[model samples]
Target: MKKNTIVTTDTIAAISTAQGEGAIGIVRLSGNKAYQIFREIFSPSKPIKKYQSHRLYQGSVMNGANTSSLDQVMIAFMKAGKTYTGEEMVEIYTHGGSNVINSVLQRVLKAGARLADRGEFTRRAFLNGKMDLLQAEAVLDLIRADTDAARVQAIKQISGVLSEFISSIKKKLVQVKTNIEVLIDFPEEEASPKQLFDLKFILQAAHDEVMHVLKSYDQAKIIREGVHVVLIGRPNAGKSSLFNAIVGENRAIVTPHPGTTRDYIEEAINYKGVKLVFTDTAGIRSSEEPIEKLGMEMTRSRVEKSDIVIIVTDPSAASRYDEELSIAKEHKDNVIIAINKVDIASKDQIEQAKNAFEDYSVFPVSAKTREGVESLVQGISGPSLAPSIENAPVINRYRHKQALEHIELSLNAAINLIDQQAFPEIVAEEVDSALAGLKELTGEVTSQDILDKIFAEFCIGK
Candidate 1:
């Protein structure tokens, strides 16, 4: 949040690789003089005259002005029409080092091209109609995705699954809307109620599809953020150990002590290609520590809003009712029971803990022995994984959601007007609004300003 990434039109150039030494670093140029700059700085392995588009040229890049050799490198010359900026583009691959990459990039900039806007290469792709607004946003989401579930969802989105779904809906709505307008256009020649039933049928069909998709939205958002899961139980119930096991990191301080973790600790888990965040909250017990008291209050609130809650308890603790139990009941649908220290407890004791939380999927896990941990992870991550369908569409961005809702409202208005047998113009207006919403989603109705805003969020060297 402290860093401000910039985008501009002065013809950008930047080191397009991660910071640090690597096998190779790429210095990229995108703008009018991209090819010209390459020709000036890079001499191709097979030197002729003209530069070709999309061809990798093995060559030596030298600073003609400084009379210095840069590296035995590769040059990718992209012509204007097909390049990232709708201008010529070039990438110089050189030995990975701060001095070499920086020197090459500075030479490119000095020759002509400017520093790239944070994600300018991609921004130009968006500008050139290579991808939609949703897809562009998905690229960022995919880069930011920290879990398997999230990555899968973001991949689905970036791959155009969600866009295709929305497009299909839009197509159907357009047809329905067109039919209604036609009926209004030819009022005297219109079909009777029996035939009007056809229009109604179409409306119902479109609505059904839209709502069916909307049903998955809550889960999609949850997956994108990696479901917030809170652990609650009485003191010394192996909650911290279980938390460490799931995250594969000793995030919470574990001890024989009852109140080792007085606050929440979070870590990421890759469950079934889905990402989940395990939050080990404070132990629920009678405690005089003001901080512990505050932690309990926080844990209670976290339980309220969490996507999943794992109640870790022993038979003795599970048998008794407390603050955590009340929260577990309120969020019973999202709660899972973890009978901890099963290595020490009998089957009867584990069963008793399971019975106490009959509403949840209970598992007996011994953190020390790493038993039943996989099943618990599976339970949490299963719901978030990508659906088996090829090209699963995930609507993970707020912008996509907003556009969909707008489209929905417009379609609803059109549908209602059709039902009331209103004038065609009113219904047509609604259809136009719906079409506008769809256009906005795909960048067909966007401006350069919006494009700048979107690309500016990317890392400077991306």
Candidate 2:
């Protein structure tokens, strides 16, 4: 960015309300010329000639040319340093309509403020230091959150969970930095075998802490967004029925014939504060039909890529599941054997399924009747689930994970160097690398292009 272009061309204005009819619509403004334009035409309900920051007044928005009253409204003024952006701000809360609110915004624009760029308001907030980079990312997550679990994770980030974690790592990094400086500055006095041995202890503890956080990342990632569960099995195995039951909606078609669901159907659900992205993929089988073959190949891909795989099987055709169950056992870290159509099966047939898939966690449930179905969800992610994600590190974005991974590698390298009694200079390089990652996470050492990319994803009036 050019030095001259840093502050933007002029004062800006925008319609903050979602474009539609509502009880109220807000026209927001920010910049040096904000109040000057307001004073020229606003006829305050009381004390019309003067205004103060944060004071609300009843008023009528008028076109300066004709003095025509556009709408009845209440205006709220915010002083610099106290508003969303650290600039003078004005909000005109008019009765909502496409015509009146937009007309009022245009009038403000004519008075001199330009229309706001996408996320410019919040961008200004970041420029003014009201919030850090992580919190700004949370703003988007909170807006697009599909489940309560996602919202909760976003709120944790906004409330500084990630910040605190970064701080903890930074504290360790600071100690490592101090040790390196001590060795470099006074090699004769400070660089001794005893000092090196103590430094090893410090590096080991820091490395362990990083590993602990890394171990919990899987749980955190799932809770922050949702676990991707892909259902793949032979057709007529009640796969769609299981999806509908779990989603509590008829999200997928179910019929007595094979290959009824030709593609995948997705649905979101919060299973006790843990969101689940349940997908019903096409049945995995060879077919003469091109679309079905493509779908079957896609199902295989989804099953391989997903965090969890659920294979639905019918008790009547339990013979096919012997091989399927073996595969599930091989990938036991994320596999659930779901035996559907239990309502139609006899007690002996249900028992046979349980015995056949003994190596995997098999659940016998009737998705059509919603009987014993809730248990399957509860087992994977629910209140009764053994592991809880309370205070889990909220690293949902790939950028954050990459940064943390750098920290992990650097810290581990430092630990190895310390163990091997490698030179302090080599250890210092690893420390510096770790510090760079932590700084990037808080955006202390980030490039303008990255910041632009981050904020550019936001909508206008953020």
Against the reference, the lDDT scores of all candidates come to 0.75, 0.79
lDDT, residue 295, candidate 2: 95
Task: Residues 1-462, candidate 2: write the lDDT tens digits.
Answer: 111124542578999889999988989999888887777647776665567789888978877745778788898778776887778888889889989899988889889989898888877776666667787788878877776666777888877778777888788788878988878777677466777777777767777776776666666566566788888777788899899999998879888888899988888787766678888989677788899988987887777778888878888766546667666876787888888888889888888888888877888888889887898987667532433547756577878878888888998898788788787889899999998998898776778898889988888777
- Candidate 1, 140-211: lDDT as tens digits: 877877766567667777778767876886787678677766777788886577655776676667666666
Task: Give the TM-scores of the predictions, in the order they appear.
Answer: 0.82, 0.87
Best by TM-score: 2
| TM-score, structure 1 vs. true | 0.82
